[model samples]
Structures are given as C-alpha cells and as structure tokens.
Target: MTSAILVSILMTLVAASTPILLAALGELVVEKSGVLNLGVEGMMLCGAVAGFAVAFSTGSTGLGLVAAAIAGIATAMVFAVLTLSLTANQVATGLALTIFGVGASSLIGAGFVGKTITRLGPVFPESLSGHPWLRAVFGHDIVVYLSLALVFGVGFFLRRTRAGLILRAVGENDASAHAIGYPVIAIRYGAIAFGGALAGLGGAYFSLALTPMWADRLTAGRGWIALALVVFAAWKPGRLLLGAYLFGAVMTLELQAKAAGVTWLAPELLATAPYLATIAVLTMMSLGRKTGRLDAPACLGKPFSAS
Candidate 1:
C-alpha cells in the first residue's frame, strides 16, 4: 500500500478502536472494584442514542456527549442498584440491564431514527491535523486523544496510587477491606458509575464521530467486544489499548477489502470477521487461563453484604 493509504488505514483504525478502548477501560476499573457488569453493551446503546438525540436537537456535539455520559450513568445505576444494593445475581442482573437498555434506547431513540449530524471535528487546527505525516499523530478528534490518555491514566490509577491500592484491596477481599475501614460498597458504586460514564462516551463516539447518524443498535455489539477485551488484556489497561486496535483492524477489514476491490470474498463474510475474531480471541484466553496465573480479581461478580 502507498504511504498515504497506510496513513488513512492507520487513522481509521484509531477511530474504530477508540470506542472499544473507552468502554474496556471503564470496565477494567469496574471489574477491579470486584464487580462484573455485563450491561456495558446496554450502557453504550443508551449513550449512543442519547448522545445522538442531544447533538441532533441542540446542534452541539459536546452537549450530546455530555448527554450520552449521563444516559450511561443512569443505565449503569440500574445495574448497580440490583447487583450492589439488592444483592442480586450479578450475571443475571447484567443480562437484564442489557435487555432493558435495548428496549429503553429503542423507545427513547424511536424519534431519532435516520437523522444525521455533523461529525465530530479534530481538536488540532487543520494545519497540524492535515499534515501529511503528522496527521498520524495530530489528526484525531478530542475523544481519540482522551482514550489514549485514559489508558495510561487508568494504568497509573490501578498500579501507582493509594486509592488504587485500596480499590485493589477491595477487589481482592471486600470483607477485609470493609473491616479495615474502607467503604467497599461505596467504592464499588463509584467504580460502576465511572465505568458507565466512559461506556457512554464510547457509545457517543459512535453516533457523534464514527457514523454521525442515528440508527437502532448503532453501537452494534462493540460493547460485548469491550467486555471480551477486558479479559483478553487480562484486565491490564496497556494491553487493552493494544487489543482494541488489533480488534479495530479486524473490524476495518470489510472497508479495506472494498477499497481494494477484492471481489472473491463476500462483504458479508468480511463483516463477520470481527465478531469471529472476538470469539477466537476469547477461546484462546480461556484455554491459556488453564495454565497461567489467575489474573482475575478474586471477588469479581460476587455480592457483598455487611452481615
């Protein structure tokens, strides 16, 4: 491929990866706090539709993003209340949340179907953003850069900070953490809220940046991929970043194939590649887990009561 073509592909990969990376990072924190939320897909949908609605209605992508975050938080709180407060089954609750999200988004977004808006713009001025070679470094929008910054930020927060240590302690042994004066339940609530907010932003990236339009299930199943990415990265932020891009490359194969005018493979088959890759990657992770040190937080998905 020509250098220009390569640059274009690279840019596309970054944009494709940003939403998954954003959602995975939020989930990493949520899992680290001993909660396994499977409703990430639901949260993303809520964010996507809300973000699109606000942006289309107000003519402000920024406001749309804010709305998306709020929607995500609201949806996540439902899961939180069930799993954390009522001490409901985490797995079932998560599944229910996803169902609720689909219905809620469909109902709330019914009026927004088929609408379009201006796509999010690059943060840097055109001079830098449009530079032939420098575009690789400067061409992305604010959310793209924010996702990169969050990768390091999450890694730092999990590994280097006192609060991180405490969160880890909670994940490792919530009863102990609670006995030691840390508020296990409260910390978890904060973690869940944070994850929901990021998941919302990730969903917003789809409506406001990637497609710049409203569609039912606009996020598709990227949320599930984000969930797998957490395990694929062994819950490490750095690995999650790399994994997101790898999956992003897989996801963009359809576009690349069409661009190359390869007629042998059907576009439908190419479209399935990313989901197939997700299944394959997850299978490998499961098999590898049999031999490796268990990397999962011990208390993940377990309920805690102050009894």
Candidate 2:
C-alpha cells in the first residue's frame, strides 16, 4: 500500500481501537476493585443511545458525551444496587443488565433510526490535523487522545498512588481492607460508577465518532471483546493498550479485505474476524492461566457485606 493508504489504515485502526480501549479500561478498574461486572455491553448500548439522542437534539457532541456518561452511571447504579446493596448474584445481575440495556436502548433509539449527525472533529487545528505527516498523531478526535492518556493515567493511578493501594487492597482482601477502616462497598460503588462512565464514553464514540449515527446495537459485540481484552492483558493497563490496538488491527484488516474484494477468504469468515479473535484470545489466556498464578483480583465475582 502507498503512504496515504497506510496512513488511512492506521487512522482506521486507531479509531476502531479507541472504544474497546475505553471500555476495557473502565472494566479493568472495576475488576481491580474486585467487581466482575459482566454488563459492559449493556452499559455501552445505553450510553450510545443517550449520547446520540442528546447530541442529535442539542447539536453538541460534548453534551451528548455527558449524557452518555450519566446514563451509564445510572445503568451501572442499577447493577450496583442489585449486586452490592441487595447482594444479588453478580453474574446473573450482569446478564440481566445487558438484556435491559438492549431493550432500553432500542426503545429510546427507535425514533432515531437512520438519523445522522455531524461527526466529532479532532481537537487540533486543521493545520496540524490535516498535515500529511502530523495527521496520524493529531487527526484523532478528543476521545482517541483521551483514551491514550487514560491508559497511562490509569497505570499510574494503580501503581503509584496511595488511593490506588487502597483500591488494590480492597480487591486483594476486602475483609482486611474493611478491618483497616476502609469502606469496602463504598469504594466498589465508586469503581462501578467510574466503569459505567467510561463504558458510556466508549459507546458514545460509536455514535459520535465512529459512525456518527444511531443504529440498533451499534456496538455489536465489542463490549465482550473488551471484557476478553482485560483477561488478554493480564489486567495491566499498558498491556490492555497493546491488546486493544492488536484487536483494532484485526478488525481493520477485515474491513480492508472487504473493501478490496479479496476472494481468498470467505466473506462470512472475514466478518467473524473480531469475534474469532476474541474467542482465540480468551482460549489462549485460559490455557496460560493453567500454568501460572491467576492475575485476577482475589475477590473478583465474590459478594461482600459488612454483616
């Protein structure tokens, strides 16, 4: 491919990767706080719809993103109340949240089917964003740059800060953290809310940045991929960045293949590329786990109560 074509492909890869990275980063923090929320997909859909509706109505992608985050927090609060407050089964509640998200987004977005909006533009001026050599680095929208910054920020938070130690303490041993006077359930609620907000932003990237339109389940199954990506990265933020980009490259390849009309591979198989990679990555991680100490939070998926 020529240089321009290569730049286009790279740009596409970054755009495709940003949402997953954002979602996975949120989920990573949730898991680190000892919560295994399986409703990332559902939360994403809710955000997607809310973001689209607000953006379309007010003509502000910024406000749309805020709405998406609020909607995500609201949806996550539902999970938090059920799983943390009422002590419901985490896995089951998560599944139900996904189902609820699907129905709710569909209902809210029904009027928006086929509606279009202006895509979010890059933060930099056209002089840089449109520059031949600099566009690759600066051409991305605010969310893309934000996602990259978050990777480092999250890594620093988890590794360098006192609060990070406390959060990790909760995950490593909630009882101990509680005994030390830390509020276990409260911290978890915060983590869940944060996760929801990021998931919302990730979803909004679809409607506001990726396609700039509304569609039923526009996120498709990327939430699941993001989940698997957490495990694929062994729960490290830096590794998660690489994993997201790797998956992005795979997805980009699929689109490029279709555009090129390559007949060597079946179209159906090409379409399944991302999912197939998800499965493969998950399986490999599972096998790797058999030979190593588990890297997951010690209290992951376990219900906790002060009583």
Candidate 3:
C-alpha cells in the first residue's frame, strides 16, 4: 500500500510539472539567443485567457491551443519589435511587456471568471490505462509526453544542428556573427516568437486541461520559476528537465503534506518550496564559479544593434 501511494505521488509530480517544463524550455531557447525575456508571466496570462475564451466559444481544445499560441506570439512580437528591432533595453522592455500582459489578461478574463470549460481528456490508449507500469508512465495527457520530447529535441538541436550553431554564435557575439553575414536580428526575433508561442501553449494547458477553469493570476509566478530554471540548468535542455521535475516534485510533496495533515509544516512555507528550491539551485550555480564557462549567453540582456 505504501509503495502504491508513493508511485501515485510520483505520477502526480510528473503531471504537475509539465506546464513548467514546457514554458521553461521555450525560455531556455530565448535566453540562449542572448535575449532575456522577463515577460513570460504576462505571455502565460494572455495564453490562459485567450485559450479559455476560445475553448469556451468554439468547444474545441485544438483550436483553443492554436489561438493561445497565436496570442502569445502576438504579444511576443511586441517585445521583439522593441528589444530586437528597435534596440531597446531588453530588461525594461520585457518587464513592461509582462505588465501589459497581466493587465490585458485580467481585463479580458473578467467575464471569464468562475467559468469552466470542457477539458482535453487524457491521450493514452485505453489498454495502457489499466496496465500498472504503463499507466504510471504513459497515461498522462499528450502535453506531458510532448514536453519530454521537447527536452531531448532542444538538446539535440542545440548541440548538433547548423542552425543551432548559428543561433548560439549569434547569442555569444552578435557583432561577430553579423560580420560573418548571419542575420542576427532575424534570428533573435524568430527565437523570441517561438519562445512566446511555447509559453502560451503551456498556459493553455492549464486553462484547457489542468484546471479547466478561469481565474485571474492563475499562473502564480510559475513564469518566474521557469526563468530561474533556465539559469539553474546552466542553459542546457537536459538539465532543464531535471530542474523542472525536481521543482514539480517539491510542489507535489507540499500538497501531499498539506493533505496528510502534517502539522509541523506551515501552509505558507509549503507554498514557498518551489521558489526556495529555485533560489537554492541558482545560488549553488553562482557559487560553483561556472558563469565564465557553461553559464548564460554572453550577450544576454544586452541590446544588439547593427552598426
């Protein structure tokens, strides 16, 4: 019985972590291009509202997901225009973008408050659902499996692909990349938009699948945690998977502790576990003296302009 319970708990952790994994993976690519986007929270909020609205209106989860991606990409285009094309400060522009996303999402979601929509059902084969081991591993929604696939996909692309090499080169030194005839601005814009679309998809997962309910501020800073995970993982996709699962496990454990009537743990402290873990991982990364080597993009947060 104890073993069964433990397995169930682990399964729950995997499910809870999928959204964070998806969003973090997108942000990982964005930062890899030497662009620091702080507007993930905003983009996610927009996706949440947009996805919920579309799902409610059309009664189609597929269309809702597509709309969410479009909304996120549209919002990201604003950031791309300001930071990448106009050479505005990445940090300030990202923050402003996030602020806009938050307000816009809230106002748009006002009518959606307290609304519930039909959720996307689990995507596994019925045969697998009853098999104990397979159920534990494969019975989640399609998004969970896709998130895992993305982790490996991004890792391989960054390490092996020619396009990935060019992206990395651009992030490392845009001036040098530009001198070599690479389209630095175009690369950044595309990467930023891709990141935004992925983040939006993550948000839609919450509204259309996880909770299937609308609420203001529903993301609750998962975006910030995703940002931290990029740094904690040393900008590597494989490590991002580990970091996301670890945070997800911590979050699940907190909820379990609360449910099991663990009196010694304060509710507030339990809620802080994921954030605390992020801070700890970041501190360790910084203290380990890896910034000069396997750390952030060389030009991260720096505005790039063609001379």
Which structure is stronger by lDDT: 2 or 3? 2
- In model 1, residue pairs whose N, Cα or C atoms come closer than 3 Å (at least 3 residues apart or on different chains), thus clashing, are none
Error of 1 at 81 (Å): 0.8
Clash-forming residue pairs, model 2: none
List model 1 lDDT by residue over 239-280, tens digit each: 999999999998777688878888899887778888999999
Question: Candidate 3, after superposition: displacement of residue 43 in Å?
Answer: 0.8
RMSD of each: 1.3, 1.1, 1.5
Which parts of model 2 have CA positions greater than 4 angstroms off?
Answer: 289-293
Per-residue lDDT of model 3, residues 1-307, tens digit only: 7766877887789877888888899999999888999999889889888999999989888889899889999999999999887888888998998899889999999999988888776677788865666678766777788889889998999999999999999899999999999999999998999899989988888888878888888888888888988988889999899999998998898889999988888888888888888889888888888336557889888888897
Candidate 3 local Cα displacement, residue 228, angstroms:
0.4
Candidate 1 Cα RMSD after full superposition onto the native fold (Å):
1.3
Whole-structure CA lDDT of model 1: 0.92
Q: Please list the residue runs of candidate 3 whose C-alpha ends up more than 4 Å from where it truly belongs after superposition.
A: 290-294
lDDT of 3 at 231: 84
TM-score each candidate. Answer: 0.97, 0.98, 0.96
Q: Which lDDT values do the candidates have, in the order given?
A: 0.92, 0.94, 0.87
Positional deviation of 193 in candidate 3, in angstroms?
0.8
